[model samples]
Target chain A: MDIIIKDLCKSYGENTVLDSLNAVIGKGKITCLMGPSGEGKTTLMNILMGIEKADSGAVENMPQNKSAVFQEDRLCESFSAFTNVKIANDSLADDTIISHLEQVGLGDAVYQQVSTLSGGQKRRVALVRALLAEKDILFLDEPFKGLDEDTKKIVTGYLLNNTADTTVVMVTHDIDEASALGADVLYLKDGKITL
Target chain B: MKNKSKIEKTIAVAAALLLWQLASVIIGEEVLLVSPFKVLVRLSELIFEKEFYSAVAFSFIRITFGFVLAVAVGIIFATAAYRWHWAETMLWPYMSVIKATPVASFIILCLIWLNSSSLPVFISFLMALPIIYTNMLAGFKSTDTKLLQMADIFRFSFKKKLVYIYLPNIKPYFISACSVALGLTWKAGIAAEIIGIPDGSMGEMLYNAKLYLATADLFSWTVTIVCVSILFDKLFMKLINTMFKRLEDL
Candidate 1:
């Protein structure tokens, strides 16, 4: 189902972030929202993810089940990567998690606690967690922040392959990221989408 | 490595004991204080006495029961307060009263209201509950919101969320609460017993020594209580540490 957001309005105590924004995200396709920093990209993503409530707007056909790579990694640092993925999965085999990690080049560190992994490794773990989750929608918020160019290519390839045919909304500042993922880009400005 | 450290600690303690004996000999007054050697002799003699064992057992059981009860109730109340603002406001004045009011006053009032045997238990519980509740709630509140958001999005089960996320963050707070409350419970429990004068309790032994002007016995029993309190703290900490280490491994 297409996610139809209409007349979206939001404000934070005299600072308006979004105003009468409207967009339609196609079903089972990657939609990348790109804007300058502080252009309400993250805010819009948060509203769509149901983490932040829109002040006066309506979101239609949002999936009941969603998974995300938040602005932060948001991993359980004390637990192993395997445990984090397992916690999100419902009856998924352990081998499924291992395969996703291997595809993302995280196989060597899958058994290590997230606290012991490097920043890029942790980001990949977070990506694997989102991809492996049983969800109809996936959101990524600048998931490539700490990754180098080569690792980013490998992770982006894995993300695209895993999330293919799954409805995805990603927010990023990099055009290369949008191009690499073959996403339809929506330029966000003054809280409204300009496709 | 562990055994070597333990032996070194034992030698250090022995050296301290010798210094204590030397200081006591130079002072030469039993009422002022007894030497460590004398206290050890008294401790050995008391260990053979049935009354000593009974007193120790009685106090240990009651105080530990009170502590466990307090921990359970504190977590429940703290969770309730976390969920409802009104519950937090309502509990403030009562916790404040408990914190500010003296243990002796509570013991005397409780003596009128409860059986002599139960006074220590009641006092210990009253002393321990508020601190644990406050610390646990603080820990719960400090949990990362972003992580909770991720958990929500992924539809993690309540049990999994608690075990994987909450437990790791809440542990330090729980440990701190236990360490602080354990000592306070012991102090309040024995103080209550002394006021209530319960039979078959360490408090009774101390009181009897006081009445007869047996300063040596008083010091000996006081030392025994100190030893027991330290043992309880060390043993409780060891058990909790081992559990958390295993949990982290899992």
Candidate 2:
């Protein structure tokens, strides 16, 4: 089911974040939300993911089971990459988890703790966790923030390839990354979206 | 570095024993203070006596029971308090009173209601409860909110959230609370025994030593208590750390 947002309004005290915004996020396709800081991109994602609420609007058909690579790598620091991914979908076999880590070049550190991993490595683990989870919707918030060009391409390809059929709404500043994912782009400006 | 520290600890202990022996000699009165050698001799004799083991075991069992009970109950209540604001508010007064009131007061107060045999258990439980509850609750509160948000989005079960999120975040605080509480329970428990003077207990032995002014017996029993306390602390913490370390591996 596609997520449909209508007349969404959100605010923090006197500061209105999303003032009567609307968007139809297509199902089984990547929607990249691009905008400057302080725009409603993240707020929209939060509302759609049910992490936040819209004061006066309706979000229809928000998937029941969802996963995300948060703006911060929210992986458990003491757990290994394998464990972090397995934590998201523990029913997945260890062999499958190992291969998923292998796809993102985390095979070497699959058993190493997330705390010991570098920033880019941790981000990959977080991305892998999202991809491996048994969820109908995936949210990626600046998911490739720390990776270099080569690793970014590898991880981005790994992400898109594995999560082809899942509805993904990703937030990023990189238009090139948005294009590379072959995502339908939507730009947020002052609580309004430009498709 | 670890080996060097071990050697340094041994040297420090030897120096302390030498200072103790010099202090006994300078005092020059066996009634006032017994030499380390004499205390050691008394300990060896006490080791052979069935009553000594009985007293030690009696006090040890009750005190340990109190500490274990406090830890289990503290964790349960701290979790509930973390979940419900009113539970914390309701418990605040009792926790404050337990923390502020003197252990002697609790022992004396409990004496009127409880059997003298149970005084150590009750006193130790009272003394250790606040430490565990406060520390564990702080740990629960300090758990990363963002991670919890992520967990919610991912639809983690209560058991999964506890194992992956709560356990790791709260471990250091839990260990610290246990470290302090273990020592406190022993101190307060022995004090209760001394006051209550339960039969076939270490408190009775301490009371007898004080009444007869048997300095050797007093010194020997003091050493026994210290050894027992230190050993228990080390062993219990090692076990806790081992379990957490295993979780980290997972």
Residue pairs in steric clash, candidate 1?
none
Complex DockQ, candidate 1: 0.84
Tens-digit lDDT track of model 1 for A1-195 = 799999999999988889999999988999899998998999999999999999998999999989999989999999999988888885879899888889888889889989999999999899988988888999999999899999998998888788878999999999989999889888998778866
Best by TM-score: 2
Q: What lDDT, from 0 to 1, does candidate 2 have?
A: 0.92
Residue-by-residue lDDT tens digits, candidate 2, B138-227: 999999999999999888999889999999999999999999999999999999989999999998899899999999999999999999
TM-score of every candidate = 0.96, 0.98
- The C-alpha stretches of model 1 lying farther than 4 A from their native spots are B1-15
Q: lDDT by residue for model 1 over B1-250, one digit each (tens)? A: 9999999999999998889888889999876767887777888899899999999999999998999899999999888887899998999998899989988889989999999999888999999998899999998899998888888888888887888888899899999999999999999998888779999999999999888877778878998998999999999989989998887776
Tens digits of per-residue lDDT, candidate 2, A1-195, equal: 788889999999988888888888899999999999999788888888888888999999988989998889998998888888988887999999999899999879989988999999999999999988999999999999999999998997898788878899999999999999999888988778866
Q: After aligning candidate 2 to the native by TM-score, how far in Å is the CA of B206 from where it should be?
A: 1.0
Pull out the clashing pairs in model 2. none
State candidate 1's TM-score. Answer: 0.96
Q: Positional deviation of A53 in candidate 1, in angstroms?
A: 0.8
